[model samples]
Target: MAPRPNIIRIGMLVYPGCLRSGAVMPFDVFHIANTLSGLRVAANRVHFDTCWLSARKEKTLTVGGLSFHPQPADLEALDALMLPGIDHQGPYDLSPLLLGLGPEQEMLRRYAQTGKPIISSCSSTCLVAEAGLLDGRRATTSWWLAAYFRKRFPAVTLDAEQLVVEDGNHVSSGGVTSYLDLALWLVGRFGGDALRQSTAKVLAMDANRSSQAPYIAAAMIQDEGHAVIERARRWLNQRLDRTWNMAELAAHCHTSPRTLLRRFQDAAGMSPTQYAQQLRVERAKALLESTKLSLEDITGRCGYEDVSTFSKVFKRWARITPREYRARFGLRQ
Candidate 1:
C-alpha cells in the first residue's frame, strides 16, 4: 500500500437557505470513511477532520429550518473547502438564492488564492460561479438549472449531463443527492479507491450514477411568469406530438421570429426550438414512466417518427436509453 497522507482539514460552509442534507449527509459519509480507514490501517493512516464553518462566525439556519452552531474556520490552514447547495423553491428563481453570500464568496476567494482544491455541489456551484472561481473553468450544476446557469454565468461551460466535473482545483457536482457522489469522489481522490468502494457499499449507493440527465424534468424549467414564454410553453405543450416550425410558433405568439427569439433568450434562457424539444422530451419521459407503450409508439407520440432519431434525442435529454428509463421509473404492474 502507498503511504497515507497527513490529517486533512475539510471545512464545510453552512449558511441560511442551504440544503440541510447537502450540508449534513456528506459528513456522515466522511465519518464512515474515517472509521473504516482507522480500522484498516495501523496507527491511523488517513485522517479527515471536518468542521462546519459559517461565513460570519455565528449560527446559520438551513432551508429546512435547522440551526447549526459551528466552529469558525481558519481558512488559511484548511486542506479542502466544500460549498454545498442552497435552496430555491420555484424554477428559475435563483436571484434570491445568491443573496447574502458575498462574505462567503470572499472567504472562498481567499481559499482559492491558497491554491487548494475547492469543491461545490448542486446550486452552490452558483455561489462558486458568482465568486469568479469558475470563470473559464468547465463546471456543472443540477441538470434542471443548466440553461439558467448558462444565462447567468456565460464564461463557465455548463455540462448539465455530468453528475460531477473536476477542473483543476475546482470540483462541482450536479443535483441534490449528488453530494454523496462528490463526497465519494473526494474520498477516492484523497483516501484511495478501496475506501471509496467500501463506503459506497456500506451506504448502499451506486457510485456509478454519474449523469443528471436521468433525473431532469422539463417542469424544472420554470416560466418565471414571463408572459410570452408561458404562452409559448402552452402552445408547445398542446402540440408536442406535432412538428411546428419556429415560423408557426412565432405567428401563433403574434410576433416576428426575431422578436420571439429575443424574448425567449431573455425569458427562458433558450431558443424556441430548444424549449419545444424540452417539452417533447418531457412528454416522452411521461410515457416511459407511466405507460407500457413500445418505443416506436412512444417515439411517434413524442413527435419523432424515426426510432434511431428518437433514441438519440431521448438519451441526450434523459441521459439513459428509453428502455432503461422505463425499467427504472416505469410503473410495474
Candidate 2:
C-alpha cells in the first residue's frame, strides 16, 4: 500500500470567466468525501484540505455571478494544484481568451517546476500545454478539441479518449464536466478505492467509468477542412443510411482512393472510415435521444443490418449501448 497522507491540501486555481461548476463541483466532492470519512472506522483515513486560489486578481473573484476570495500563489504550502475549466463559446472564442491567460500560464510553469502534482481539466489543459508543461507528456482535453490541441501542441501526446491522464506528477483530464471524474480520482488516489466507492455511491456517479470514447461526438469533424475531404464528408452524410467503401466515396468526391486517403489523413487526423463511423455514432445518438425506434430499426437506419454489430460500433464511439444511452439521455414522453 502506498503511503497515504493524513491530509491532502489541493489548491484549485480560479481565473476570470472560469467555469463555475469546475471550481464548485470538485470542492463539493471533496467536502462530501470528508463527510463520508466520518462514517469509516478505518484508522488514518485521509482528509482533503481544499481551497480556491488565484494570482490576486481582486479582493473577491467573481465569475459568472459567483464570488470567491481565493488564496494567494503560495506554491510551497500546497500538496497539489488543480485547474478548472474556463468558459468558452467553442472554437471561435477559445484562442482569444487564451491569449489573456499569461499570468495563469506563468503560475503553472512555476508550480510545475516544483515537481508536485498539478491537475488541469477541460480548457485548462490548454494553459498547461501553453506553459510547456505537457510537452512530451500524455494528456487529454475535451474530445472536440483533439484536432486543435494536436496542431497547437505537437510536442505533447494528446489522448483525448481518456477521462483522466496522469504522467509523472502532472495529472490532466478531459472537458468541463470531467472535473467530477478528476475529483473522484483524487479521492481514490490519496485516500483509498474503498472510500472512493462509498463516496461515489452517495454521489450517484458511475465510479467505474474511465474512458471518454463513448462521449465522442462529430462536432469537430469539419475543423481542418480539405476540399476533397469536405466533398467526401458531404457525400457520406447524404448516405449514412447505407454502407460505403473508400473507393465509392472517393469517386463521388472526384478523387482517387489514394488521394482521398492522403488528404483525409492530413485533414481529419483519422481515416475516412473512422470519420464515417463517428458520423454513424452521432446519428445513432440523435435517433436514440429523439426517437422511440426499436434497436433493430435504429440499426438498419444507421446502415447496420445487424443490431449486435450496430451496438458494437456505437459502443466503440459512445461507450455505452444504444439502449443504455437512450435510457439515460433519451426524451421522456
Candidate 1 lDDT over 140-251, as tens digits, reads: 8987787678878989988878999999999999988898998898788888888899889999999677788778776665545577887888889999888888899888
Where is the poorest 10-residue window by lDDT in model 2? 217-226
Candidate 1: give the clashing pairs: none
- Please write out the lDDT profile of model 2 over residues 1-333, one tens digit for every residue: 544548889899998978999988999999899988766765647789999889756779999889998877789888889998869877546777888988888888888888899989998898888888888889989888887778788999988888899999988898788898889888998878988898899899998877877677775635654578777778888888987787898889888898888887877778998888889888899899998998888888888889999898898788788888999889998
Q: What C-alpha lDDT values do all the predictions have?
A: 0.84, 0.85
TM-score of each: 0.87, 0.91
Alpha carbon lDDT at 95, candidate 1: 72
Stretch of 10 with least lDDT, candidate 1: 56-65
